[model samples]
Target: MFSFNDLLTINGISPQDVAVALHKPANTSERQALCTMIDEDFAAFNAYQSTHARIPEATLKARGIMASFVMTSDGRMTFVGLFANAGSQPFAQAGPHVYALFVRMTRKMTGPDEVNGRSGLEALQNRLLFDLSRLDTMSDLSGRLIVQDPGARNYMRVADCTPLPVVELTKEAQMTPPVPNWDALVLTAPDLRKLPNSWRVQLSAWRGVYLIVDRCDGARYVGAAYGSENLFGRWSQHVAREIGITKELSQCDPAEFQFSILELLSPAATADEVIGAERKWMRRIGTLEFGLNT
Candidate 1:
């Protein structure tokens, strides 16, 4: 049987680093006791191998694309963390593949205890940081993610064991052409939450007419921002309330909402003018009859 050390050697991690990880205390309470965890992770991994025959061999040959399987034990979700080429090359040279981003798929949690930090996927990276030492190399790719919730099952793995579809992060996002106008910028609720600081600065500078389109039901809500904080401030209010002006908005999943600017007005725009534009939009879209506007 391959002890953790033998597994590390097969995964291309150095002996010196392996020794440090095993003996070192990751934190005050938990020492780096990864030997058994690694075994368990692999056992889960191997269970799927009957279908993915090449996973074990391919993982050895592929140098990039590290992965983590974050499974919620309660059968609510299965989060897959895909690093472009995490272990195939040196850390510094891996380019954008070095950073980690998490995706949450499926049911919502009832409390913060379900996740290590604040509820939602936003805190996923922070949770991953707690396991930084174990994720140091490809050998530790499949470390178990332990959290306060027994319902959460988090494990990191090489991309090879179960090849997941890659979301192009680095090159494509950079290559995306900039939106020429604020009216053209469309944002999802999650995108708005992750809105860049620079973009927020520009948005905060003006009042505007905006639209909230619910992707799930094709409902539309027209609203205006003419307050002192301007469009950015108004949107921040939406984030704060986490709902829209209508009863429909209050009930619908925020993930189903898409926000966009209809028209941008000067900072001097009055509240009446903003509201007038909003009403015009509602009328044009028949939001009061068919959508969420009240």
Candidate 2:
């Protein structure tokens, strides 16, 4: 029944001072609300998370968010980083409730710029940022995270959080858990644009028969991916076009399409093998007779 707050205390950080930034970018709107840090550079991603917060400065300073327990929400949460918070300034260039910059504290909240405005501490402050590797040493709380659902608030006080136990922990959390394998893969039209790198890599090397169903009316399109383009590239064509490939789907919004794998093939699968599978799926699914396939 050990909790994340317990982990914080063991590291010598009081539960009272730290506010965990629970990043739960489960959908398109959610991802946009949070800075899209996953696509950012290595060190820069943590820097982005450090400076970013949707909570107002008053609440941040009032509750004393000296560090952020960076975790992403996508079903099983993954711990990303533990960043020491210094102080935060309003995001003048952006909308309200978002901070533009956060002055960061060192690992133990001891540093010069920890006061909000100071010089020459960026490199030193960045060193204070710790990733999952540091957390893994505490207790083997990595494989398959099992904590109580961290509710809707994106940020919470560690003091208020101590009562909640980290139900179970076994392995380090991936930036994203390995997305469902191809058999379980289902992609929203919006996901294609912001596809997780893990998913992009899987699709990049896969050649397969795929299906696109209109989210609005359930009209399905069976297609195939082969040659140099692969499934990733082929799926892109659906969204990249203003008008879809078929006469039926062209009348419907492309964003209304849902993409999924119909049948997977090896990278060594032949063009004939791919197209033949595509035909098999189309016939079995009745795409040619009643669906959007052309």
Candidate 3:
């Protein structure tokens, strides 16, 4: 029964004079743009909102908007901040009639690195992304405030100046769970890419042998990490490959693959030692003759 503008009123905002902007990016490139912004690229995110295709004042005035509430897709339409429409100007040589909308924001949630959600992976800050447990109250501005999904895609609209009703508040808080034990992880390609930074840091610090199993037919791939990024770097690159892993798995579907750690090795482990462990796993798992390692 609690609402968004109600939270605004508590913050001294007169909802009637405000417009609420919902940013739920659906395309891959747009999603990635937003992801980077929330994680470590605040300046870029700021510039992104500050510059935009201009919306005529006549159009804005027709709607009685004098201020703005911009929310990004973090699992739900979680409010990131409020801005004043300082007006617009041309952006580079980009052709006519085009303009940029500059805004000054007061952030309400914690920083992206302090968060552990899918947003860093392009599905997350468009990803307040996780646990807006404080929705009905405004005592703590550090936690994100959730607005009920408006159910429409009109990115900008007049605010009701009251509570925008929510169906369920906690459903959208999906995120990485406590980093988990290494052996307990069984990640999909999408899962790997969307993991939070803390987990990636841990993976980056270790040298290890890992496994990729094709879910489609139980075909396996055995790989080792001893170079720069260690397990994190190697695995990230593996997931990032568009066509396939090595030339051997080219004809297979990458989406059907699941990733996991087979054995953890010391960071000081030599490349030969790592590969030696890899060979052992290959023999144990029968991955060389029947799996995807070439």
Candidate 4:
């Protein structure tokens, strides 16, 4: 039966003072005192660190204190506290308001696994502290884009951008035209994996999508076969034959030609939605490639 007195003694605070700071009436001192006790206990529990050593003072200042108790959707007790702020006053003065805000935020953001069947306030406290730290680091870009390299297990901030001018080495160099192949194109394993196993029944189905990409100063065609399997092999062969015949007979050597299967989309999905998603990915990949090349 831990009580407000216990919390006050541990944190060097008085129960009555906590009540006053929290703006709870002394007549309901027991309830106010209990709330303060829980808040302090959770805060201290979250503050402890192991491998990371001490938490930075600046981080604490920014995110405020964390707690070891989290409120659940079903109104049950969990030993996990989330990142929290105590406002700009002592626990007694700001405790109630902060606790209410913490409860509200937890209800909105967390799922059942996070707030259920947990004990050991320290564990909950530590998890929340780590989360807060990560969020703070992510948000502090300092006006630059922050990207993570999973292979290297590190992060980098890109700050500068300088474009290189496209140059033509020879004055007689001519722009090569593209050769479009009406035939089928070969798809990669990743592209093939996008379609479901049931798509094999409809062999002639080609309602997927296509894109024109610039690769190595040449145009490359990419197509996807939605709800279709074994289509990539047939399409690739067809495309190769078409390109071979057309480029060999053309006066101007066709620009380097290549093709790939991007991805399969749902049958009901719209072209605009699919294209929007593709464009977003392309932009990201293009930015990374440009940065690496430069």
Candidate 4 residues 65-145, lDDT tens each?
Answer: 332222222222222222333433222232344444444323222311233322322233332223232123212211121
Ranked candidates (TM-score, high to low): 2, 3, 1, 4
Measured with C-alpha atoms, the lDDT of residue 258 in candidate 3 is 83
* Candidate 1 Cα outliers beyond 4 Å, as residue runs: 1-115, 118-180, 245-248
Give the TM-score of each candidate.
0.44, 0.71, 0.58, 0.19
Query: Whose TM-score is higher: candidate 1's or candidate 4's?
Result: 1
Predicted candidate 1 versus true structure: per-residue lDDT over 1-294, tens digit per residue: 223334445767533332111112222111111121223232322212111113332433333333333322222112222233223222223223222111111011111123332233342222212112124444223232211212211222332222233222132211112334786777665544534455567778878789888898887888899886787777766655545544657876666677898888778878898899888888998888987887
Best by lDDT: 2
What is the number of backbone collisions in each predicted candidate, taken in the order shown?
A: 7, 6, 8, 11
Model 3, 112-194: lDDT tens per residue? Answer: 22233322223211211111111223323312445676666556567763345643344333222345687876777655555
Root-mean-square deviation per candidate: 15.2, 9.4, 9.6, 24.0
- lDDT score at residue 87, model 1, on the 0-100 scale: 32
The sequence of per-residue lDDT tens digits that candidate 2 reaches over residues 1-294 is 777777767877677766555555455433421223433333334544444333433334554343333344345444444444554433333332212223322211222212444342333332222221122333334324455556765454445554446765655544444567888888776667655566677888989999888888887889899966699888887777667865766887777778889788989989999999999998999999998776
**Candidate 1: 10-residue stretch with minimal lDDT:** 103-112
Give the backbone clash total of model 4: 11
For model 1, state the Cα shift of residue 261 in Å: 1.3
Higher TM-score: candidate 1 or 2?
A: 2
Model 1 residue 206 distance off true place after TM-score fit, in angstroms: 2.8
Q: State the local distance difference test value for candidate 2.
A: 0.57
Output the lDDT of residue 220, model 4: 39
How far residue 115's Cα lies from its native spot in candidate 1, in Å, is: 4.5
